[model samples]
Target: MWDLAGTLPLPLGVLDREGSTVIVGLNGLRLLRDGAWKRARAEAGA
Candidate 1:
């Protein structure tokens, strides 16, 4: 997840492993919901 998040065009926010939550910033969340995560993973060949 961290690896995929790193590929995002915008900055992601605090990732809390203990809570198993990814607190993404507003823009990052929007992008992720818009399929940025998949695109990033594909682009990275992951």
Candidate 2:
């Protein structure tokens, strides 16, 4: 098993009055085997 903990060195928030409800941040994931996982992508739309 493994665990990951990180901080977003910049500002990130979910504003309500500004008509925004999503904030993006970065995280690093490491596995015990040998592979690597980076840049988890996401999209928002109606």
Candidate 3:
């Protein structure tokens, strides 16, 4: 997740590479604002 200000990258949860799974709660996901996500994705060219 990213902060609403889009200046910091917040830790949303954990990822298990071997298991190919991500552990994130609903609240954590909600912490990410749409604008921040869109800005980040655009910057990353994703």
TM-score for all models, in order of appearance:
0.31, 0.13, 0.30
lDDT of each: 0.56, 0.28, 0.55
For candidate 3, lDDT tens digit of each residue in 1-46? 3355575533432223323443345446755779878887899996
| RMSD (Cα, Å) of model 2 | 17.4
How far is 13's C-alpha from truth in model 1 (Å)?
24
Q: What value does the lDDT take at residue 16 in candidate 1?
A: 46
- Lowest summed lDDT over 10 consecutive residues: which window, candidate 1? 10-19
Candidate 2 residue-wise lDDT, 1-46, digit = tens: 1112334232332233233422221222233324332222222221
Off by over 4 Å in 3: 1-31
Candidate number that wins on lDDT, 1 or 3: 1
How does candidate 1 score on lDDT?
Answer: 0.56
| lDDT at 29, model 2 | 25
lDDT of 2 at 1: 12
